[model samples]
Target chain A: DAGITQSPRHKVTETGTPVTLRCHQTENHRYMYWYRQDPGHGLRLIHYSYGVKDTDKGEVSDGYSVSRSKTEDFLLTLESATSSQTSVYFCAISESTGSYEQYFGPGTRLTVT
Target chain B: AQSVTQLDSQVPVFEEAPVELRCNYSSSVSVYLFWYVQYPNQGLQLLLKYLSGSTLVKGINGFEAEFNKSQTSFHLRKPSVHISDTAEYFCAVSEKAGGSYIPTFGRGTSLIVHP
Candidate 1:
């Protein structure tokens, strides 16, 4: 319960459409991450932000882009949704003062058809 | 770059039975290891992590893991598991620093505990 929440708990979009998933936090953590969970694949990082306006790519960041404009919000966008991008997306936050234990949001299930 | 391997794709056990899930990792530099659990229809939760110091790390739900640097292993273990312990367990590793702390996760092991 780190006060993390993901919007649009579920979504369905056609291929080649733009989709954005939102993550909001209230604990004011310094680090926020975006990850997608696939069957048998565990969780793979898509993007992460260490601070406001500072972000980096992850292993599966090929078609995903992320931006963090405020300390509490991190947004993940799919330029053009594809069938392969359909998965459960999770947002996690870590604090600079704690043991780096990541707290996750419930998740957002996106289906690209 | 770092990678993690979960040897068991699935494990089935009865209540009160001891269980162990094997994990192995590869990294050139010092790395941090972690175990995460994902219940049905939920996000992954950190079970435990090995940052520094102790090789043996205990996490919630009576779960523990031992980091063997020489063997490149951090296997998750429990003396006895309960029905509620059934979930998908993931082994992950991250660089100590420099690489944004983005973790690489294994394929995951599905643990099924029966009564």
Candidate 2:
């Protein structure tokens, strides 16, 4: 199986608190993405990293920031958590081949009160 | 800016019946299409993808999709579905010509296979 792991499988926090989600990959892929899954919206990309220290925003990047200090780790942080940010966060990785296929992590369920 | 559309939001079928989940896309550039299935409480898994060459692509779990470039559609189909086939299916598109590799996903279609 492809090695992708997301930390804190489930978390419940209050609004205005800061939270961080970690995605670690052992495959050493060059691209990493952060997505939030909701009922009707499917999975929306919040942010993504093409390489270490190289990042970009996605369709729904508000209130979220990401960092890739190492090739195997990508971190997503909510500077100020909001109830609307409550959703299942998934970490995905793809090679630099420019193909669209991605491998996803099990996901981290976050609930903001 | 690419977008994917899953025409049917939900489709219910009896076990062993044939099924189809429609998908369409809008993109200025050529695109690579993909279908992903998410089981209950689990992450999404790649069902199939259409990169290049063949128009019809077969994937695990007896599912297949055909890429119709003229219509900008990639619809998933299964001849005989099992109860375990019930899951949420998403259609995604990424620029085949250029830009970041991030995919644009549709709203998703929920498949219900009842016994």
Candidate 3:
């Protein structure tokens, strides 16, 4: 297991409210990623950071924003939560993107009512 | 760009039965392949990966996958399965693009082992 942790393992929020999910890693991996898992959709990347203060949008970065201030922490913020945004979010870290595999955190389940 | 395809959405089998999960991928250039398993309410765990070398790659928990470059497929297989093997399996392919390595994932295939 990797030294990865996701805060607020579970959360429930109403629609139109702002919510932020935090991912922290102790492995000091160079690459960090955020993904959402749905029933039919296995896993879709939300955003990822290659280095501190640097981030890029994933395929499903429509209403999500992420920030990485340091090497260990990556934050995903939903400006105004929506019911459709309710899903399980997972944070993963990889030493390098080339041929290395990713390590995943337990995951955070968010519900938007 | 790289993409993955899991041929089956769900496969049900009896415990101790042999099982195989199909995975196919498409990429313009040479790519890396990986297989991951996700249990209920848990995150994905790497089962195995094929970067280079021999086509047969062994992984954890009595699992293995054979990477076929000609077919562009990395299919996961297990000789005998237990009840604990019930989980969702995902196939992924990674390739370098725009100076960054990006991975594309397949919609998982649920493996249900019944007693």
Best by DockQ: 3
What is the docking quality class of candidate 1?
A: medium
Candidate 1 lDDT by residue in tens digits, B1-115 = 6778899999999999999999998886778888999999888888999999999999999999999999999999999999999999998887776653567789999999999
Tens-place lDDT digits, model 2, residues A6-78: 9999999999999999999999889999999998898999999999999999999999999999999999999
Once superposed on the true structure, which residue ranges of model 2 sit more than 4 Å away at CA?
Answer: B98-100
User: What's model 1's lDDT at B100?
Assistant: 35
The DockQ figures for the candidates are 0.52, 0.70, 0.78
Candidate closest to the true structure, highest lDDT? 3
Sort order, DockQ high to low: 3, 2, 1
iRMS, all models: 2.9, 1.5, 1.1
User: Residue A102 of candidate 1: its Cα lDDT?
Assistant: 81
Q: Which candidate, 1 or 3, has the higher TM-score?
A: 3
Using DockQ as the yardstick, the better of models 2 and 3 is 3
lDDT digits (tens) for residues A1-113 of candidate 3? 79999999999999999999999999999899999999898899999999999899999999999999999999999999999999999999999886889999999999999
Query: What lDDT does the true structure give each of the candidates?
Result: 0.91, 0.92, 0.93
lDDT tens readout by residue for model 1, A1-113: 68999999999999999999999999999999999988878788899899999998888999999999999999999999999999999999988512367888999999999
Candidate 3, residues B1-115, lDDT tens digits: the string is: 5678899999999999999999998776778889999998889999999998999999999999999988988999999999999999999888755423767789999999999
Better of 1 and 2 by TM-score: 2
Measured against the true chain A, the candidates' chain A TM-scores are: 0.97, 0.97, 0.99
